[model samples]
Target: MSTVAIGLLWIFLYDPSNGPINQFTSALGLGQFNWLGDPNLAMVAILIVVIWQFSPFYMILFKAAMVGIPEELYESAKIDGANGWKQFLYITFPSLMPTIVTSSVLAIVGSLKAFDIFFIMTGGGPGNATEILGTYMYSQGFVNFNMGYASTIAAVMFLIAFVCVLIIQFIDYKRKKRGILS
Candidate 1:
């Protein structure tokens, strides 16, 4: 689903009185909780939506990585009397490094650029509790009509995202080199 749709759905689901989330919580004796309306929970609410939206894609990526792991490695670990945890630590975990690195880079950058859902859901409201750089930039540019500040914000966002990706890649490269050298 589109970000807008996801945001809208969550907005409904987070409705203070009638939303299913509130209903579920009430059923569990937690009472109806205002999600987006509550400053404390607004960011958490957005995070929950983000995770709900992104989990399936990551799951598929990890599943493919898991499937690609060589069966011989597992057999070798078994012959060496490695238990399940050891096998995972030595064999499966290392094999999934590339996928994990890629996922980390994507997540770091994507999160920095996340705007639509935040805009749709809260517009950085409830006293800016859910405000991120993207939302702030948008507000400065479009809502407040501050072009220069908005442009600067955009540039900074780009640099931050670029640096984050580069850092993650560099770390992954160094780790890979160390593993290969060993």
Candidate 2:
């Protein structure tokens, strides 16, 4: 339900031909904006929208993880006279670390490859304010008819994503090896 609400909000904010960002900026008393104007505001707004659109899945995952935690941990903590914060810090956090890392990685990949929402929202316009690598690749390939460059961009994006995942996995592996992971 929450996810559906966020998705609807994102759709409402997304305007291919006309966005409300300019009106918002002017209304906020951000000074007379001419050259360095609405695009900046729109970019920020779009980012917020994107994060909001993506957040519900993370929220669900976190909620489930939290609920899945055995009550015994808290009970034991209570017996030990550990406060809620202390118990959370010493127990819940360590348990949730892996879930958080996994969810973050998924979010990063989703962001890097995101296009549909952005395309419908901004069309990578206002001087390319919302031009992500994914959209940029599409523009270069289809819009500009430069398949070679677009392919190169695709390769680079893939490399960057692969490297990030590799680094995260490596760190996780090391932590597990060192008996630091739960």
Candidate 3:
């Protein structure tokens, strides 16, 4: 939704043939891609796009966690002379830590494995500006016909993902041991 708004704003604020984005790209000393015909804003642009795409899930998780917090906690914080910001800092945020961490791990995994969006938007072009692990794997196996190398990349991706999940679980376990797994 925010991405759509940004796109609409871009259309309103920039020219088609030579958009404000192009001017910004030119200032950065990068050339345009023949395929996209858009300037070399692919890196920043794709990062923005990925963040936008994943934000909704984060927002929903945040809202659900906030809603799950008991009202008594807020009342107690207020009774203890905690201001709004202080209550959020000492109460709400601590209570939400596990959920936040989980969401963060998911976001990282999703970003690492993302391919469809980058493929459709940039095709890993403009000099590999938006080449992610998944896109790189596809290029290696299909485009370059190096199945061995592609499988290697796949194994690496799996290892990274496994490590991430292990880290999340370890942190969760420690939190539980410390009685912090609220």
Worst 10 residues of 2 by lDDT: 13-22
Better of 1 and 3 by TM-score: 1
Model 2: CA > 4 A from native: 1-37
lDDT (C-alpha) at residue 83 in model 1: 98
Lowest lDDT 10-residue stretch of candidate 1:
173-182
Tens-digit lDDT string for candidate 2 (1-182): 45345545654544333435435655788533332136866677667776766677799999899998899989999999999899989789888988988986897777778877666566787688878898899999999999999999989988888888888888888888887845
lDDT of each: 0.92, 0.75, 0.75
Higher-ranked by TM-score: 2 or 3: 2
Query: Which residue pairs clash within candidate 2?
Result: none
- The regions of model 3 sitting more than 4 angstroms off are 1-40, 179-182
TM-score of each: 0.96, 0.80, 0.76
lDDT of 1 by residue, 131-174 (tens): 99999998999989999999999999999999999999888888
lDDT of 1 at 162: 94
Q: How big is the positional error of residue 136 in model 1, measured in Å on the Cα after superposition? A: 0.7
lDDT of 1: 0.92
RMSD to the true structure for each prediction, in A, is: 1.4, 4.3, 5.2
